[model samples]
Target: MRFRPLRSTPTSSPTLAMVAEPPADMRAVVIDRTGPPEVLHEASSPVPRPVMTELLVRVVAAGINPIDAKTRSGKGLSQAIAGYPAVLGFDFSGVVVQSPYESHPFPAGTEVFGMLPFPRTGGSYAEYAVVPTLSVARKPTSLSHVEAAGVPLAALTAWGLVVETAHAHEGQRMLIHAGSGGVGHFAVQLANYFGAHVTATGSARNASWLRELGATTVIDYTSTRFEDVVADVDVVIDLVGNVHSDTGTRSLGVIRPGGLYIVVPTHSFPGYAEAAAEAGVRTTGYRVVPDGSALATVGRLLDSGAIQVFVDRVFDLAEAADAHALLEEGHTRGKIVLRVSDD
Candidate 1:
């Protein structure tokens, strides 16, 4: 599906209208009960209003992260969304329809994209959303709405781990597992940008692509063990979670003493942290929180050609079920986005 790009120049803005109020109900992807993808229902919900520190945005597109589907399957949802009827999505791009204050960075009609507050609302899979002002930023001018929609969650997760948490600096060596996955791909580029020598692990077919994305070394995890290939690494960013605990444990062996190993998946293994400690390395388990400032930082990088956005696939909003199915296969190259109509 094709999308109309948001005009990013000062004189060029999106041609969206401003009305006194929106309709009482709007279309949304609602999970009435947590089960499978088939249980997801499309229904009408109230058009959310902008409260203090919030902006009401008309969603042009929403990005699908693997965790969104995971949480929907009764795996990640907590008491925050324990009720049956729930909205599921975190990353989105759209026009700011209204804001609580006039001094808002995103005034009415500003084009923006970022990760919304998760668990508490998870309402980005809708025609409109009420998001905190600090949780969003001006959308990148170089990308279309659908492409920009793909940036928030996965990209930020990669950035926060490589740049913020691990502080992977120049002349350092790092290894990233699952180099072709959403977060893995970004982690590769970001690490390289920080002047680090990056080694990444993926299938044989993805090795060339990973190199093009700035991976100094690419390992086909299918044929060889990455730990056996890389040694004395400064950092290891593991995105495969507990499902690959052994790989995470082995990652510590590659990092030198006092280096860092950061885990990006849900649960942290008891032995993984202990092994890192035993090896005289630091270990951290992270969960991403919404950060608009980071989005602005990323937007500037994108605008200056410092970073690139990787979109593995685009699905229409109605084909959300198919998108989730593809992501569940565990081999998506980059990010998957759901394109919504301007009407």
Candidate 2:
């Protein structure tokens, strides 16, 4: 099946006076009951139409994140906002199919990629998605649909912490945990790009690769305790959370006084702030927001090769359960994406 674009000519008068009938149904991954990866299965649903300031997107590829798996298992933020039989996914690259407004920045057939509003039903794991114009941006011309799809959510999260929250700058010391994972890798690069001295923690095997991504110091978490070897750091971006023995709390021991520790966890872990308070440091839990403008700036970085997206694997849409299983393992080197269609 192929999705064709809709085109419109400029006119002073409104072209679409009434809502158009969307497709009867479209293929997607739907969860009837939250449980395990088995709960995520391929199904069909009515295609969503562009309403008000929205645009209907023909999704070419969808990116997989740890949150997708958590939500599938009834443990993530989406549990509260998503109804049963919900389509689970957030990041996607696709073409604009129907535009409801003339003032929409992208016209019909414009290729775009973005992370949909998180903790909500994005329905990106489908052939079609309805997204607000403010949440979409033109895909980076230099990246394939698969690559662009791998970016949005993870990249934006990294950008939010490093640039927006931390305000990391030249000569500042920044430490990032799980430096080889999706968001960690990007945070390392972005912090480095902003001229901070970068330190990262990962397996010994990924030490060289993390260094290549701009980490001046790569600590093998298995062989050395990062808190023991690294100190007086300005920022600590903790992606590991409390998974491996109170990583969030232990990270507080490494930051200098007045430094910031940003926690990127789907669920809140206790004692993060208390530990930081004792250490005379700041702590914050960050959730990524949909920002088309910030994503566009990231697209420019991708186009210029200042930053690179590492797609660890790509799964077919039919194998979304398998993708979820892999992501749940929690050791992917980079992003895992689902190829929805050929661009």
Candidate 3:
């Protein structure tokens, strides 16, 4: 993981010139060996210098996602990691402290938020992070750093599933599983905002809340089997796969013939394609990619209050293990975020 040095700093910002540079090394929660949550411990890591079109961001907060827990347990993207002492985080909200070049659109001191393609590169579980210029957008003026941190990866995933893949539109009927979860909550809102009729599955406790997010029908998974009640839907966004129950396979039976069944987690099921084929429905797997342009559009929607991001809890950087523990319990209403540095 060698990086080229930034020969030219963003000197155009007078404030940037006056401020001292970031520390050479920073405090980060890291794991030398993948294991349980307790494996995450504090360590001093070199503050990465941005190269090429990258920018150095002083991370104010980082969002916790299910993938973080999976990777920590030697699953998910853990195989993609090149070495030990890996820092795992995907979504971040922070200030740009170093730009690829002077006079860049997002210069030093500019507030931004985005997701990192972790393992392929370093991640956000640190005080400072290396961010691609095109992977970030100006943070929404309406959200604080903690709130903003919760948006990127989850929102992008939902946007990709609902709008980009399903083409959510008027009269389109969509079923969203785990509707109160980090990505599920966003899926419900984006589908409704795009004029789709939403039916969501969640606990009875979350039923009213999911309705508030625009789900016309909220199925309590504890009380009712979703496949029995939901049928002939235009799209089914399955956040929970057959790993928990027969969710992925059962979801196929609900979608109308030719309807799309989008599976979010590949690790959750083994043979979804064969299941969807037998059920006579079209299917696809989805993975969220960082997109500043789409994120910028999402920022606009956020600022306008057309959609909302719910932060279920906030933990300090050192409490990353606790955050991961909560995530594994699978009951979080929205997103859980780690406060890395003060905004």
Candidate 4:
């Protein structure tokens, strides 16, 4: 799908009259109960109102993440679901239709993208979403809403892992597993951008692409064990926990003594901390929280072409189930996004 580019970031939009108020109801992808991807269905729901520094947005697209699928399948944030027929989404990109106030910087029609407060309010799956102001930022002008939609949660997580957690910098050596995934891909780029020598593990097909994204070494996990070829890294960002292939445990062997091991999927291996301690490595689990400031900074990097977000596929909103299904296949190079509406 083609998209109309946003004019610029932090602009005083003149199109405020076009979006004075939202409609009474809106289309949404809701799950009657947590089960599987097939449970996601289209339904009409009331338009949520923006209260207390919130913005009502006309959703142009929504990004599908691993957590969305997990929560849909009765894991991840599923335990926190308040009620049935629940909307499930976190990342979104669109235009503001209702501002916090008349003088708010983000007047109606200003383009933006960010994450929703899932569990608290997993409402980004709808046509219009009420988002807290601090949880969103202006959409990168260089990207379409679909691309912008794929950013927020995944990129923020990567930023936190590579920049905040690992403190990636020159003279550092980092190993990232599942290097082609939504967060892993960004982690690879950010680690490299910060001058870390990055070694990544992905499939053979993604090896060259991962290299192009700044992976100094791309280990094809299919043929060889990453622990065999890589060792003594300053940090190990394991997106693939032991759930699939004992990846988290195997990663402990590759990190240098006292180096950090960051587990993105915390529950994938609950005993990981104990294992890492035995291996003489520091370990911690990381979870992403909404941060508009961090997202805005990522936007600048994207606009400057310092980094890029890969959208592996796009599905219409009604095909949300199909999107989630594809996401679970675990081979997606980057992100899968739902085309919720036009820009």
Clashes (backbone N, CA, C under 3 Å), per candidate, total: 0, 0, 0, 0
- Candidate with more favorable, higher lDDT: 1 or 4: 4
Cα lDDT for residue 195, model 2?
Answer: 98
| lDDT, candidates in the order shown | 0.83, 0.87, 0.91, 0.91
lDDT per residue for candidate 4 within 111-182, as digits (tens), equals 999999877875688899889999999999999999999999999999999999999999899999999999
Taking the tens digit of each residue's C-alpha lDDT, what string does model 3 give over 1-343? Answer: 9999869655554554212588999999999999999999999999987788888899999999998899999998898999989999999999998886656889888999998879877789999998888999999999999999999999999989998899999999999999999999999999999999999999999999999999999999998998778789999999988887888888888888899999888668788888888888888999897999999999999999999999999999999999999999999999999999978
Q: Estimate candidate 3's alpha-carbon lDDT, on a 0 to 1 scale.
A: 0.91
Q: Which stretches of candidate 1 lie over 4 Å from their true place?
A: 1-20
Q: For all the candidates, what are their Cα RMSDs to the real structure?
A: 8.6, 6.8, 6.0, 8.1
At residue 329, candidate 3 shows an lDDT of 93
- Give the better candidate number (1 or 3) by TM-score: 3
Over 4 Å off, model 4: 1-18
TM-score of each: 0.91, 0.92, 0.94, 0.94
**lDDT score of model 1?**
0.83
Residue pairs that clash (backbone atoms under 3 angstroms), model 4: none
**Candidate 2 weakest ten by summed lDDT:** 13-22
